[model samples]
Target: MATVSQIWPFERRRCLKAHGIITLLFLDLCLQCVNGYLSSPHVGQEPPYSRDAQPVITSPVVPSPSSASPTDSDGYAAKCPSGGQCNRLPADCINCSYHHNCSYGKLASFSCKAKRGVHCTAESGKQQTNFSLSITCQFCWQLDLSQYRCSNSTSCMTVACPRKCYNATCQVLDHVHCLGKRVFQKRLYCNWTGGYKWSTALALSITLGGFGADRFYLGQWREGLGKLFSFGGLGIWTLIDVLLIGAGYVGPADGSLYI
Candidate 1:
């Protein structure tokens, strides 16, 4: 049997050991509660736990619809059809491409130019010359027909709308004749003779100057025959050519430039 003094000490030691065990159990309960709020130990060591702590009060806050995106005032202007974002766009935005769906190069080109029509005049020469035409009045080229009039209203030269450039009985070279100059007659055509019939002689000179071929152009049978036989006054045709123009044997060819 334990004595009174020994029993008292033994009881005190048992009480202390019991208290320590209770304290350890309380600490373990505290750690279990903290596990709900925080992560578990990474390796093996348990985290510090406060034995005097109490449960915390919490009320979670939620988002509202209006606050979903306060920054977007226009609510995103529907991406540029060009497939671009609401914040960015292709060059063809003017064409209403919200997604940038059009070709990049084509969009850039479309934005670079404007629509316009073609305009022309004799003087406004440009990069596209063939696309324009002269706007000058062409009435000066019209033929006059008052010279062959027999009476106030009766005229041998009728002003037909469309006739040969130089029609007979139509004031015969009225334009140049009024200027008092020599002109071809219908008697013997002068392809190249000295006269106001400037075109035929010029044409003949350009087409037949080499072989004295203009002899045939002027309808001078004798001269042409001689030239063909002797090769252009190689013998004396040149002398004849000089004499004829001086004597007025030849006139402008094609009569009155009718052809």
Candidate 2:
């Protein structure tokens, strides 16, 4: 066996070497753990589910108002009618629409000077001007009929009656002629007899003047009440009402003349 001192020194050296190897292995493990933690993706940041993300921004598309076309009250573009003197007629008839070949704007007013009709009148060495536009003037008979006369009695017609008169004959009585052979082609106005009768109204006024019967018959409710309450203005009003009704001065409440 070796001496005791020599054996003690050898064992001491082996213990120190084992301790150094363990220390080195521990330091290497610590360094590897630290490097792995630093290399991880989520080491210093919060989780994606922790908070709300910002929204992406983009430009909005909008339509231009000026790109839309104009429309009328009926939801249609106003266009001129195909036929007649629509080009010469007023723009108000169809909301300012005019013929494509027309020389002037449809809304513009022109003189009726050379135009053949009763509307054209000579005054102060100038032709009369027309600003009032009428659709009736587009028709032939409505434009002028001063030269024609109805051969039948005037009492046979009413304003509400149809244009066709089987019993009446339209004859050219004057030298002037109407355009488009409209002497009998279009409507003709004769004596107008309304719903109320003049003779009946006059009789009622004379007979029941104190009771307002005539006013009631003529559709004058307010006047009827006045006459009834005031006792026909103490008879003086009765006489005056009689004369007025007979003279055709007092008409129907509906603005229609008595027959």
- Per-prediction TM-score: 0.20, 0.31
Give per-residue lDDT, candidate 2, residue 80. 26
Please tell me which predicted candidate would have the highest lDDT against the true structure: 2
Candidate 1: which stretches are off by over 4 Å? 1-210, 252-259
lDDT of 1 by residue, 1-259 (tens): 7789989988999999999999999999999988855665554666699964532213212222323343443433332232222122221121111222223222211111100221222233322212211111111122133323211222121222232232222222211211111132121112221333334544554455335555566655666666667766564655555455434444434333222
Q: Which ranges in model 2 have alpha carbons more than 4 Å from their true place?
A: 1-192
Residue-wise lDDT of candidate 2 within 10-104, one digit each (tens)?
Answer: 99999999999999999999999999999899688765673333212122121222323334323321332222342343222222211122222
**Lowest lDDT block of 10, candidate 1:** 107-116
- Taking all chains together, the TM-score of candidate 1 against the true structure is 0.20
lDDT of 1: 0.36
